[model samples]
Target: MTRESSNPKPSPNDKIYGITNIKSYVPLLLDLDRLNYDSWKELFKTHYIGYKWLYGTLTQSVLQSILKPNATAADVWKTIEDLFHENKETEAMELDDELRSITIGDSTVMEYCTRIKSISDLLANIGSPVLERNLVIYAINGLSHKFTHVVTTIRHQKPFPTFLEMRSMLTLEERSMAKDHSRHVQASHQDNASSPTILTTEYQNRPSHYRLNNTRGRGGGRNQRGGSRGGQNGGRGGVR
Candidate 1:
């Protein structure tokens, strides 16, 4: 058999890093390093594959800044690490600010929660992990005011809600509130459509002469009482 057919070609999928998942790409690089250590040729081939993956995934600006004419995989990996590692603090702070400023406005409970968790993951990767309790607090604080009742109820309960518990409760509560609001709006529209005609019809059905008489009777009752009091005062003056 020919040595040319000794080894199978690497898969095309293996030529790409995690793409949007840079965190996973680092560990994969480490595993590749360990596996190829026994042979320089295999190691060089692995590095070349990694370089290709990195080149394909990186933006044009990033490629221009970091690309070396004859760079190995290790060289590309080290350059990426150095560039990102130097700005760890800045990255962490930005993540922290994002977490702090996140709100449930215009986003569903699930979306808001996902964003919070994403920021938390980024912070952890940057070495400034948020504690579970603090994360829970941040997530709750970012909720819309409609959740205040649910939040207050949860806080008052013993053993306080876990992050998962809070998330579940908030999601359920959001759905419930949405349903209630929809029902209320539908009912209001129905009431408006049906009630206005009934009210107008009732008013129109009443005799106009009867309404005039009723209005005059109420006014005359007040005027008659005043005149009676004045007549009694005049009678008392005459008796004096």
Candidate 2:
């Protein structure tokens, strides 16, 4: 019969204690890379320009204050440092760069990363508003009622009766958006069929323009960077 000891220390190398046990960190980073690249690819194809914003010191510093148990930057920093075994300050300059290269292969990943980071910083300064929240603002400005009338007539139904109903309904504004998007898709299809397609993105790579062009003596247009990302629409046309 032995009494339980009160003073027990945990092992430093325990699975839950050390950063080395964080087997999923690298995987999470990979997943983020894939998601970001896919999103960039689709946006590029759609001719969407990216932008960014930045967070102010006070609002961002206070962001953790309303958490369930309450928190501070110090607390959050400690968590990162303890889990990653490094100084978190060195991690957050209020800005960090992590962007991938475009598949065009003309731009360096770092140059594009700088632009993406600038856009992110811009978003931070604006304190992003949840999209639906702005509907009321639109309503106050009269745009909502105009669309509401258009939608009711098209659908042969009553105006938006409840927010829940709005969730599944395609209102007039949405219809217009869909119509515009469909037109763009049709236009691109026509353009691609026509050939000499100057394309964009970081997706499942189409194909390299040429491998070892100097050795192979291939012919092609040279992009602005003098890096060989130029070629025919559906051919092997990428040079690094």
Candidate 3:
């Protein structure tokens, strides 16, 4: 049997901050570029540290595509920028399409709003930030038909609600509608359950001759009076 080595292989650094995509870290990279340009060597040490962290964080495929032997932080940064910056328009269009096509469906108001905000953030990073008014409109348009009244109410507001405020109102409306539907279902079930008992009680309380008396009319009342008078006359004749 071959003897195994007692020393364990070192694990990858878990604490290193990774950049998953090019869009999110552009601002940080730009700040580093400004520092590098000024020749702030003391401050530039931080950039070197960040560069190593980035190298460790990047996936094998990304590293293979962008990595240059003995590359400076600025070099790596420029490579990432060149790759992503060229495709900014395509990315922006895709994000815009995603924003426009969203519908509430089975998602809660909060969930729907969160998805919209996420898409907005991505668009902003690509230099196509959505306007606040347009964001509000997109949110309203994506809601279900049950929210028509809420949409109308929002539209009539003078200043209109912010995204957060609108989300809160919609969530409240969703809860209220759910509560009302629950009550209606419970009421329908109660009515169905009690129907047999109600019918039985009504039948039991009915008069024995109700069916026969129900057909009596104005002529029946006149006949009853005439019979009573005839009975009185008959008694008088018998006495005579």
Candidate 4:
């Protein structure tokens, strides 16, 4: 996508404390990728559509993480150059948090939470905000909710779901919710054709091999044979 001239760059007057200039942040960014996320760097290249976007996102996330709430654009850029010394992600409870703390941290999280909490004002925001918003939701839910909000939302899961899967899930959530809501409207309209037919089909005699006890977010559980779900989600597509 071509950069639009209408979109203004940060003004010098805007003081973003705690972040570094994109150029100065290069070494630290590379270090972040190598220290624990080396695999992601390669995967970013492998991803065809958003290679540059993912890299820029990594950069943007890193900038947002270190910046304080009151920081200006310059403050953010300046802080980035001097952010942290060692790999402090190991200190964070989840690997994604550790990375995001230095990568996309509280600022991004806060912004996203704000957006989700206020769906009405979303249109006033920028384009294609779902990815970031979904990420924020995932992070927040992971910290609080009872779903498999692991190191990150399943949407952002690296290997199995990939970035694409997250988008799909987000889309699916919207579609499912819309369809679910449509039932009420169909009742008001009294048009039988307006209502969607409910189909609860069961796969007859299906093998029980796929069943396991992976509750939403309470952690592992037993299988049909009552054995521990050793893999713990068994969906570890995370890029280490």
Find the candidate with the highest lDDT and give its number: 1
Predictions ranked by TM-score, top down? 3, 1, 4, 2
Give residue 11's error in model 2 in angstroms: 3.8
List residue ranges in candidate 2 displaced over 4 A.
Answer: 1-9, 12-16, 19-133, 139-167, 171-240
Off by over 4 Å in 1: 1-65, 195-240
Q: Write the per-residue lDDT of candidate 3 for residues 100-218, one digit (tens) a residue.
A: 88898899888899889988877776668899888999999988899999899999987888988888889899999999999999999977887789899898799968755765766
Superposed on all Cα atoms, the candidates' RMSDs to the truth, in angstroms, are 12.9, 28.5, 12.6, 32.7
Q: Estimate each model's TM-score.
A: 0.57, 0.20, 0.59, 0.22
Tens-place lDDT digits, model 1, residues 14-111: 65433444434333322121221113233334334557756654555556767898899889867766765676788778778888877889998888
The alpha-carbon deviation from the true structure for residue 130 of candidate 3, after best TM-score superposition, in angstroms, is 0.8
lDDT of 4 by residue, 24-110 (tens): 433324333323233333443332131233234355556456636665545643454444323343333233443233322333334
Q: Between candidates 1 and 3, which one is better according to TM-score?
A: 3
Pitting candidate 2 against candidate 4, the one with the higher TM-score is 4
